[model samples]
Target: MIKLRASRRGDGAALFDVWYRAIVGSHDFLKPDDLATIVEMVQRDYFPSTQFTVAVDDADRPVGFIEVDGDSIGALFVDPDMQGRGVARALIAATMPTDRAWTVEVNEANSRARRFYEQLGCVLVGRRETDDLGLHYPLLRLEHSAAAV
Candidate 1:
């Protein structure tokens, strides 16, 4: 079974491993330098600032995580080994608020992620030429209704 728990400071490294697995598997278009930059931002900025909910496996090993900031989901990533096992869905469902809408920015190039969010009832609201941290990647801004997961 998958379980959700509040992330502790010590979970950073393990969560980073999950991030690396997820990103490296999905964002194959990223160059080494771009990946490096993302790694730095995930470690230095995103991980510490957002409230994280970790999805753990039966043994209590984290397999995925979702980062929530205010009413937005800043990031969600699952280990490649744990993909297609509802880890992402569980992570989103665990942290998503039901009283108000929340937003997420999916990389335009990542159609799989876009589709996943869309299926979860997120609708495209806008677009951007760069990612959230000003990286040079196209982004599709999406909003999830409070009524949907």
Candidate 2:
């Protein structure tokens, strides 16, 4: 059975691979240069600093991950090959605390991600003109209420 667990020291590369493939498949609006820069940051900073809630397969290999830090979901990415099979949904359901609302930011151009989150009961609460990196890609901030989960 797939289970959720904390990410370990050596999980950086594998998570980066999953993150990269997912981005490539979903984030077409990102400029090549911007994507490369974001990739560097994710590999160097995100993977090391955050304790990701990793969804592991039967053999305990990470098939997907969600970085839910406090009230904000900083990241969520499933292996592109593993999409559409409830991995993303399971990650959110398993890790999100039910007592409080949670937030996430999605690229405005990424319709698929927006739809996914919306389907999961996340509603748009805000928007930004640029991404966290100060790039031109806009962001839509979504929140999942505690009562809905």
Candidate 3:
């Protein structure tokens, strides 16, 4: 079983591992040093107690995480080993507000993630390029009121 809970400061390193592994190991999106910096930024700017949820297994081990920024999902990652077990869906359902629209950015090349958002009723809004980071991504938006199913 998986449970969603608020993130704790102590979970920083574990969350970092999840983030690094998901982005680097799976997507090859960042270099080790850059991933390290991203993890540090997440720790400093968006720790568990601050608008983040962790998916903990029956053993009480964190296997995934989702971070919220305003009405947007800043980040969502599940341990590769835990994928396809409904952990991501559970985490999103637990963290997203029932009254507001939420937005997320997905890499155009990431078909799985795009499908995940679509499954949640998110639709393509526009395309975006992180000029500062030189990364191109697509924006998806979901309105809770309109997404009811």
Model 3 over residues 82-112: C-alpha lDDT tens digits? 8889988888877777776777777665777
Of candidates 3 and 2, the better by TM-score: 2
Predicted structure 1, TM vs. truth: 0.90
lDDT of candidates 1 onward, in order: 0.87, 0.89, 0.72
Off by over 4 Å in 3: 29-51, 131-145
Residue 1 Cα positional deviation in candidate 2, in Å, after optimal superposition: 3.2
TM-score of 3: 0.77
Candidate 2: residue pairs that collide: none
Q: Candidate 1, clashing residue pairs?
A: none
Q: Per-residue lDDT tens digits of candidate 1, residues 62-140?
A: 8999888888887899999989999898887777788889999989999999999999899999999997667788999
Least well predicted 10-residue stretch by lDDT in candidate 1: 42-51
Between candidates 1 and 2, the TM-score winner: 2
* Superposed model 1: Cα runs more than 4 Å off: 48-50, 147-149
Residue 28 Cα positional deviation in candidate 1, in Å, after optimal superposition: 1.2
Candidate 2, residue 75: how far the Cα is off, in Å: 0.4
The alpha-carbon root-mean-square deviation between model 3 and the true structure, to one decimal in Å, is: 3.1
